[model samples]
Target: MGLFIFNSSIGRKLIMSISGLALILFLLFHSIMNIFVIFSPEIYDAICKFLGANWYALIATMGLAFLFVVHIVYAFWLSLQNYIARGKERYAVKKNAPGVDWASQNMLVLGAIVLGFIALHLFNFWYKMQLQELLAKLNGEVLHVEGAALVQELFASPVYCLLYIVWLVALWFHLTHGFWSALHSLGGSNTVWLPRIKVISNIFSTVIVLLFMAIPVYYLIINLLG
Candidate 1:
């Protein structure tokens, strides 16, 4: 069964759907948490400490990493299969033709850009928090810079903040399309549920992305004024 999912077209797509849904839920929760950073740094730091390198957090982190790898690998595999199936006819399709959001046609490219930002983000934040905890235990040290300090340091720089906003914009487009498509792939598309799910997907994706984008925008404005 697992092998089939890794190999079959429909099964591969289902994997993408399930993992995409999981990531979307995580993004919603993460965006809410980020909002706290703007509203109350103390409260946000407390929340971060609560989620610190604990057993449950470790498990969730591992699950998120697994999902990311599987979802991306399968996306590439599916795209490759699609290209193969279409054969030379793929070339006949116009590049960047009208009526298509460049993002929709180049999801893989956007995903790659997003992945690059994720690596930078993990290094900037996750490694500082979680890996610092591990190293502190090993070498008898303390992790001083918590969530709020990290956020302030990163967003203090205009260049990094601008890059983050660009990444968030890409994420918005990616989620808007993927969210509804995932539901449809999962058999949520019927006479009644199809249109409803599409609308819900757009609203949910937009809200989550906007919340995330707001954090960087807020900090950038503050830093620029000062």
Candidate 2:
């Protein structure tokens, strides 16, 4: 069974589906927590402090990282496998099939864009906060980790704020397509459920991205007004 899962396309697709959904859930949780930065930064900082350099939080972060790596690997593996299975037909220029959206067709491109932004985000935020704290703890050094202050300082720059908007847009496109695709692979492929799940995907992606986008937008407003 383990070998089948490692070697079979279906099993790889199943792993992708489950891991993608798990990441979506994590995004939802993180997005809601992030919104506190806009309204009540104290709450946001408190939350960050609670999660910083703690054993439980570190464990959860590692687990999340593992899921992300597995999902990414399977995604590339499946894409390559599909390309190989298509043989020479992959080069044929054909019109879009009915019901296949643009995002579905260009998922690899969108995934690449999203992946790039994720690295930027981790560098700007995670490296400054959780990673710094982890390092300080390891060396018995002292450091302040105020995530809210860090967010505001970074987003205060019009350039960074604009970059965040671009990132969120890419993320929205990726999620809207990936959410439905993941569900379809899991069991929503039937005629009755696919369209319904697609609608949910749009809503879910919009809400999560909008929540994350709000912080940057709010900071942009402040910068403009001041």
Candidate 3:
């Protein structure tokens, strides 16, 4: 059974579906928490402190990392498999149908760009919050000012703010396609439901992306225009 899954295209798509759904849930929770920043940075910091370097949070982090690795690896693997199956004849197929075709064709490239930026994102935020907490616990010092201060520091730089905006743009594109496609892969795509799911997916993705993107932009604008 394991070998069958490893060798089958459908198996790869299944993996993508599961991982994509997991990521969407994570993003939704994450966006909600980030909204706390807009209201009160202290409240956001408190939430960060609660999550801290706790064992549960650590486990969740490990699980997320594993999901990300599996998703990215299979994405590339599937792309290579498809390309090999098509050979040079892939370029020969010019015109194509819409729907799943475009996203499936470019998912590998999109996944790579998203994964690359995610590493930078973790370094900027996760390393500061979690890793710093671990180090503080080991060294008998405080964990420092928390996620809010780090965010403010990063956003204080116009260059970093612009870079964050660019990264969020990539994230927007990724989520817009990924959101409902994951559901469709899980068998939600029917004649009656696919179009509706697509609309909802795009709207959800846009709202989440804008919420996240607004943080840096708000800080940047306030800093510059004040």
- Lowest lDDT 10-residue stretch of candidate 3: 97-106
Worst 10 residues of 1 by lDDT: 88-97
For 32-131, candidate 1 gives per-residue lDDT tens digits of 9999999999999988887776678779889999999998988898888887887775455566767555566778888988999999999999999877
TM-score top scorer: 2
Each candidate: RMSD: 2.1, 1.5, 2.1
- Alpha-carbon TM-score of each model against the true structure: 0.92, 0.94, 0.90
Residue pairs that clash (backbone atoms under 3 angstroms), model 2:
none
* CA lDDT scores, all candidates in order: 0.86, 0.89, 0.82
lDDT of 2 at 20: 93
Candidate 1 ranges beyond 4 A from true positions: 89-102, 140-144
User: How good is model 1 by TM-score?
Assistant: 0.92
Show where candidate 2 strays beyond 4 Å.
89-92
Predicted candidate 2 versus true structure: per-residue lDDT over 148-203, tens digit per residue = 88998898799999998998898899899999889988876778877899999999
Supply the TM-score for candidate 3: 0.90
